[model samples]
Target: MDTFTELFGTSPLIWAILGAEAAFWILLFGGLAVRYLLRNRRLSTIMLIGVPVVDLLLLTFTAVDLAGGVEPNFSHLIATIYLGFTIAFGHSLITKTDAWFAHRFADGPAPAKKPKSGPAYVRAAWLEWRRVALAVGIAVVGLLAMQVMVGWAVPSSFAEANEDVIWSMALRLLLIAGIWLVAGPVYATVFKSTPATDTTQRVSPASDTLSNHR
Candidate 1:
């Protein structure tokens, strides 16, 4: 506890962001548990609703912290990136997690696994890249908004202090976006698996000979 405080004491926004992320997971699993294990949909809904509430709290904390002249740092950048991804992907994440929980606790059908290769795999890769693009767009918007807020709220010198960190954050985000695009959709497209080739690889010589004879 002492170590944690010492590391984060100067950055309340960082602490708040961490707390928000922890709370998101807790509410997600807790809501699913209540829904499947306890069979209480109403209570579970309330808990799940709190997931977005956590994001709102974190956003408010960030805005207030910045407005209060807390010079922007890496933590502030993280807070915005976290918010963007959560806003972009939170529902799908919750739905996927809920399916798993339901399968485990409520005898629901198992969730379908993503295809590892072939056309389906390529499609999935493209879909994931789209999500990444959306997330990056949202994060960039958030960084801009915060930058504007800082410029408006504080003196020029104070706002200028944040420019380097803000630019760093933007570059980092772009780097991640570029890497994901190339590794996911671009790679998948370049090395896509064909159904015939996949079937041929799976068929043994004996099976192929027997089928040919038939």
Candidate 2:
């Protein structure tokens, strides 16, 4: 296709991706603003629903296009990146936004919940890993799906002439495997090792008794 044709043809896809990206950031910040600034749980909860709706629409369009053999475009990659950021930084983003909003207008201090440990910590870590794994897994699946679709849809000579570097990696399977198995436990262990405060340190029983007496 000509440059103009390709660009014009992909415009709808681009807009869809942009809409999804907008939905994510808007719902994130908008929901926090409602919860902290407006102090409206009902409204905030309703706004929060938009996040998944956007993701659902994005995924539906992606699957439809791929299943129908549309060649992958840059917008698809942007959507993937958007989803990645949302999954990875979502909680932090919401918490920080809430804290900032509350600091300014909620007339109360931000809630500072301590990190969990033992079973709760393990469960939270597992859930986080699953979220990250799903994001990474989606990228991998999308890559593979594109490869299959392109092979099916495009002429072999045409695809060979315009092969993309993004799909050229042979070690993607290894990368996906590492993301699934290695990334989670390593991150959890490192996170646990780092304390939130440097002023606190463990002391022996004698030192504790002396300090208490003093």
How many steric overlaps are in each model, in order? 0, 0
Q: Rate the local accuracy (lDDT) of all candidates.
A: 0.85, 0.65
- lDDT leader: 1
The C-alpha TM-scores of every prediction are 0.83, 0.56
lDDT of 2 at 23: 80
Tens digits of per-residue lDDT for model 1, 1-214? 8886665557878878879999999999999999998999999999999999999999899888888888877788889999989988899899999999989988899999888778898998888888888889888888888879777333257445345677557767888999999999889888865433534448789999999999
- Give the Å shift of residue 67 in candidate 2: 2.9
Tens digits of per-residue lDDT for model 2 on 54-90? 8778877876766675666665655554555465556
Stretch of 10 with least lDDT, candidate 2:
165-174
TM-score of 1: 0.83
Tell me the TM-score of model 2: 0.56
